[model samples]
Target: MIVTYITNANDECNTRDSRPPKQGLSACGLIGHQLFFHQVVFCAALPDNTRMQVSSKVITGFKNVLLVDYLAARFPYFSAKKWAALVTNGRLTHNGQTATLATRVRQGDTIIYHMPDPEPPADWVVPIVYEDKWLLGVNKPAGLRVHSQGKFIAENLIYYLRYQHQPPFPDVNLVNRLDIHTSGVVVLAKDKQVLRQLSADFAAGQVTKTYLAVVHGQPAPPSGVIELPLARVPGTKTARQQVVGAGEGKTAVTHYQLLETLGADYALLQLHPQTGRTHQLRVHLAAIGHPIVGDGLYQLNDEDYLHWLRNGRSPQQMPLIQRQALHCAATQFTHPVSGHPCQLEASLADDMTQLIDKLSGN
Candidate 1:
């Protein structure tokens, strides 16, 4: 225990400025007085590996706080790159006593942060579609996650499915994932046999996947195949994909056949991806200057959109609805168990159908 000068109760404190604490009325000096106060305790740096476990007694008003929490609450980006240098050199106050971060925090002391920090919320849930002893397929919704996360990680599709139901089958392995922004079909395997079989099948092109997309503009011709090679963009860990030379990137071929034209700005098209490159459909569409509507990562400029909107065009003409106007509608594969050809199809989900009708007035 260390000697401390406690701050008098009824004082509102803010760490807006990192200044020294001024002397204040003492709790010990007043006899027979049971007023609440801020206690300051600083411990010397003892060990490198031992983490400073922080648990505090309830002090009602001032509350419990750590040095990191204190500073992070003030300067959000409290790091060398953002504002760490200034904050690192700052001090805190105990009662009227200003103290450095090295000052130990006792029962009722407050730690001040110059910058406030809030953790960005990362959340998602994915829904499973098909699973057998060997194979599992998921109708991954847009914004659903496949794996664990910080607070919201366990709530993702895979976690939700596994947690909600304790199925007889063991750990279900996801062989693939659709982009969190792309709502579509995903496949999983429960066991190594099924995984190997499905992996082999997918590699051998035994799986035929078909998708429906609403593009930004009406495709010019009757219909055509977009066989552009694709390349994953650098720097971005994910979500940025483009077309590039064969040796430079993977050969991503998409055959886009026009399903119907809503107007001058939007067209409903069926997409057949011959190659399983990442973001194949979106990249192919964007490469043709007909990026999907609401593709935030790409298509920021509305010049093409504005030109058409100025001409009394909305997705009504092109029928580019909200979100990613793309959906995995069907998949075809031969059943490993029966050795018979099987096809699975999902009707347009409510969101897709609703958006389609809402925009096209269908």
Candidate 2:
């Protein structure tokens, strides 16, 4: 389980630490997850503690790549934990086994991606808390992606399923996506028919979504509402979503109540996004003032922070919490086909919880 940043086919350097990693689709204008075609460079025998220079073709499959030990069931190579290091890190563009001492080529096949990645094993058995033949539901962890996108193309929950379990869940699909930085319960359709039904319901606004977030500052009161139209301001690519004039924006709304204020500087919020917009929770909150902690994209840039203040957010405070602190805490909707109501939610993951605890202690 080596943590190496992919520069190309040859040069890969190890990171200081593998914690608090960073990516995916066009979420908030992000590179997001896109799949790539790759090739395998065969190795004769397990090198004696020698690192192999992976071909660039395979490395391009992921963004901010990390080389991991992939415990391939299909290929016998290394121990599972060793492989989990890289696999869990969102690395491993391809899975291969060590060529037998007397063998020739390894299991290097050009695997084409279906625009989706594997799902985490934990989520699979997490309890079909509520399930039917048509749909399956489980609480998704924070830092997990619903589909393939930039740095997380195939290292996420969706990809994990195909990698680990290919039987009962031969076809896994996400009707909607939760932010990679957010955590909560998500629903998946086992087949294409169920997928279409659920997708339609979402488009018709027949679905219900709930989220929780830890913010930099406390809202003045226990609860409040935000009505802001959001839009992409051209010329400012790679930045926090800017608040714009009505004519230049799309309709977005959020209802949030302070669940608990850690102090004058921090608060826990129960959020509900009325409309599904990119960075909806993060943008709205930033427009109001508080930015999610560790918001690498938005807060990472001071100019974007300034732009947020110019939007609807009060200029009274700068970003404190970073990252898109918003999480998809819960969701409810009638089964697209079954008509039976379904609901699910995920608890705070280690990263979020640890961040909260560390900051609170500070």
Candidate 3:
């Protein structure tokens, strides 16, 4: 059965369906003018002949605002030009009347607009290593974005999960994020409460994360702690992080132990980061002059890194590895719903495994 709700700007909820409550659905919330049933509602298994009617009331804040401007401001995914086309095509409605570009919106007016389904990548898939009613753990592949960002909205994991997964949940949230080039176990929450708990656990340093990395040049002393502050590189739009002095940047610490040497120059290391910072591991390693193998940004000089970004990845230009050779091998945390200990592990991706084999002459 399908469930529908009408939510107003004042956060009032009104359900207009006779569907029985499912297992986990709890309440409704409104973002912009889109009416969404949150927590534990599922619209799946609805009969093919049934039609869905979902809408949200225009917020009461704007007074005498153009309908097009209001829509563009509220839903940033769509541009003003797109909104014009939608308005011209009679696809938008204001209080049950056809909405045009000149239609002025008043407080509490209902604006209804439908968004086209996102065309997610067809071949994108991740292996589900562990799953329960509250959470899902997946071995996410390298070179895959965990969520929509930059120019990769439709090619990300969340979009694929929503469109391709069978019986999709009404709400699915990512508890932790992995870099696009970092292959590892990614945990997703099926319920919002689980998300909050896991988020708090991560914030309080209650979770233990382990990563395996292959870096050029064996680190001296075998194992040690690298405590360094990290901050964004000065005046660069490339999202690069760098190690700074104790007086500046955020405090970041990583404990690393050299596992083995790959031939003469390279080494395999196990990393345990005490604090989570953007590019904490990579920046710390590079700061100590032992950048991870195939890390384009951290491994190269600033000039070379920028050049590589502009020229794209070519074997001649990037002879070592096409992507960073870091894998999130394991994570330990308390299960939010079960209230029990949980451990999740993902083996090294084929690229990292093969790179190690090649370097070790196996």
Candidate 4:
């Protein structure tokens, strides 16, 4: 079951704060000037289990946009027609009053949506790697999302850790996230103070992370640095990123060393990213003509990728590997509570191992 509650957009106790109120709503963090809609799921055993979940958001930076247009852009999982139906059914409100299809929302407007809670799959198990008084580390399996997103409200790592684990960690918060197909170690902070410190450390480039990947071809140089700028492709709804002219997009740097060669078609590489950009590792490798094995979005052309997505992301389309071959092999950082250096590691997932073995004729 899920718990429903409403939180003010201007609440001072944000996601980074160490001590949020123990009762009522949970705080969702601010993204620049906009507040992100956050959901907290409670177990069925909890006393106040509810059928519906309430999500509220504060509008900003847009000028007199149609309600349906704004909702479609913000929540792409729901179509404009669906949002219209919800408005017609009186399930949405503007500033505490019922909203309609003709509603034009602007800055400072409050929109509230009441929707049913979705049940997520609960069969997958996540292995705990390390734990202490202030931090917890877990090896997230490939295909497990780090947080709740569209169509996967409760089927995520955080939801399982907080509600489904043998001993629920209700107060824990995520310190880092991995892409759904990338298997690796994920860190969570037990308290707000530790979360804030670790966040600062990440922002300051003090934390170190290493990744392993199997790419289609061998890089020319055994070891080198990739200094490329990346920007989102224009006029695309998927937010695909590509390398841009220097000084045009955000700066991204990565250091890579070839570890082993698999026959004549694939190679294993160890990567260290100096700057954290969205899809930096995958994009960098692809820009250098060695896209990671089974990365359909980056490896295949736009038309083919779109066709694959429309076809339900079938593994037969990508017979080389089931998912991207990249994995977060290790992470090193300073402990927020003890101020001691710590290092955590995760082994490669079985699928990747099998792919390598097949490529090498083992």
Candidate 5:
């Protein structure tokens, strides 16, 4: 069976080293098994002289910009200097021709940006919560992206799932996504039809996503529904959302119940969002002056957020619980294939558990 891999432009250069070196038949089988699960496979007898070239489609959002400008924006992990160098070296191309820094990319143009390979994180594992032929639910760790993005390709959960579990199908799509810094139960569909059905379930509000969060300050009424419209903050590159007027933004509703009062300044709460909006839970919580602990982006001022992005965390600027103190504790939906109810749960990650224990003096 032929499988397709969407890889960066540097894949061609690394084709020779794509698989582990051969040894005994048993060893080769083990390597092949590992690669199969990850949806990356090499020919049983790869010709020594063969090299495969790979390039990704240019997404529509980046059209009508200079090659250099669009590349910088699309792949923010690459430094301006690196982009300049790549442009100068004529490593980037458009439509099978060498492109310059000033090249204007139109819609549907294929760009070969020849990005450098980033090192994958060391020894990462995604614990399975529930798995069957049609779907998978995993306890996604904080700091692991659901899919490939800017600086994370091989390090993301989808890659790990493909390589480690080697599910029968090549296409595994995320039914839901959590922030890279938020750990929780993430659902994956084994194929396209299941993906479409699950997506419809989410859109029709048939799925329930419950989250656990620790926030600074006690909320009034302790438990209540927060009805707020959310929109992207005006004139900002950062993808930060804010509560807006009813007519101005998408409707977002969060029902929060305070579970425990950790101290005078902190509280543990359970959140159930009725509408799925970008950063809806975080923006709603922060708008009420109870930002999730360790959420540097939503909790801090804009300048502080930019500073945190550039310089990392600071003792004086960041709060306890380094990442956002939020976890998708549970998710509930009907099984798309089994025609039965399904509910999956993930325990609070060790970091959040430890933080809670410390705050509660447990």
Candidate 6:
């Protein structure tokens, strides 16, 4: 089990500066901060060795600060009290030595931690869409996370495929990721070479992705391109992306074609994202007059959204659909090994289909 940490702190949007940096734009554009997996720790037990995977990070920006404080600041998933407890229990170390609560850390210091294994959720299902010797594709359900993060480790798709699925695929690696609420076809590589090739293909804009979305209103133009640069909204409690001036944010482009109109209130759209910015589809749709149906985060005010989250994400809060009505309909790419064209697809999720049916009064 190998643990990797993303140490690019400038990608964060929490700072007062609203302008994105000139370089190092990751795959997700300005919203890379929300993709922070610095603190997430996953430990897999080997059959013979039972070796523990330790997550480590090298400090770069800060001067002499208490170790507990640094952990709390860098990894907001855990509180200071929890970090202190971990320090006391010897789960954390700095510079190859056990760290104490009062240990002061400085620049170039390395912090390592041994986290506990995760317990996956029992009631979950992921349907395989396509499978070959080199690759695997699955129709990921809405509300199912693609990767482990924070407290939700084993319940994610990768963990399930590695440990729970029959004829386990312990070495499978994700080629792309989708939001938890977005149901879609997710591609996974069976080996490292395939993973690298597929990942590079995605990063280089060589992959063509198609999506289906149910939005609140019909766009004026039946088909058009949304050429909007996106930047992270700073000074907000939660991470959010917004359209910025032409040269201010990272370039994000999405082409959308209206498919069907559901009465006068809603419409179905087919989307082709030219760039894979975080929440690009949803943000572009919302930037126009049409926000995706059941998108509580984008449609609702911050206060209301927080209230809904606090209330356990009840379905009552969103009546149109349970989750965002976005589905990754298809993906087209070249097979890394065979050098053949590959196109994989997933049907719309049940909830979105049911909502469409109801809107059509069928």
Task: Provide TM-scores for the models.
Answer: 0.58, 0.59, 0.70, 0.81, 0.77, 0.78
RMSD of 3: 6.6
Per-candidate clash tally = 23, 34, 4, 0, 4, 0
User: In TM-score terms, which candidate is top?
Assistant: 4
User: What is the C-alpha local distance difference test score of each model?
Assistant: 0.55, 0.56, 0.74, 0.77, 0.74, 0.77
Please provide, for model 4 over 1-362, each residue's C-alpha lDDT reduced to its tens digit, 9 standing for 90 to 100. 11243333343212322343333223221111122344443323222223343445645677788888888887767789988998899878877788888898887777767654436446777888889988999989998888766645566787777767889777678888888899988988998899999988987889999999999888998899999999998876565799999779999999999999999989999999998999999999999999999898897777888888789777887888878999998889999878899998888888889988888889
Ranking by lDDT: 6, 4, 3, 5, 2, 1
Q: What would the per-residue lDDT of candidate 3 be over residues 1-362, giving only the tens digit for each residue?
A: 12342333344333444676554322221122222222234443223233323355666589999988987787655678888898898767788798887899887787665433334344855878888888888898988877765223346666556645565544567788889889998888988778999999998889999999999899999999999999998987577998777799999999999998999999999999999899999999988878899898876667887788678765675676788888999889999877899999997899889899988889
Ranked candidates (TM-score, high to low): 4, 6, 5, 3, 2, 1
Off by over 4 Å in 5: 1-80, 88-90, 93-111, 164-169
Model 2's alpha-carbon lDDT is 0.56
RMSD of each: 16.2, 13.6, 6.6, 5.8, 7.9, 9.5
Is 3 or 5 the stronger prediction by lDDT?
A: 3
Worst 10 residues of 6 by lDDT: 24-33
lDDT of 1 at 144: 63
- Cα lDDT for residue 59, candidate 1: 43
Per-residue lDDT over 72-118 for candidate 5, one digit per residue giving the tens place of the 0 to 100 score:
76665667777778878876678878888778887678766543433
Count steric clashes of candidate 4.
0
Report the lDDT tens digits of candidate 6 across residue range 1-362: 12322223233212222344222211111111222334323323223212223444545787889998988888777789988998999887788798998798887787767554335343677888899999999999998888765645556777777767787776677899999899999999988798998999999999999999999989989999999999888875566788999789899999999999998789999999999999999999999989999888897778888888788777788977878999999999999999999999998889999999888677
Whose lDDT is higher: candidate 5's or candidate 6's? 6
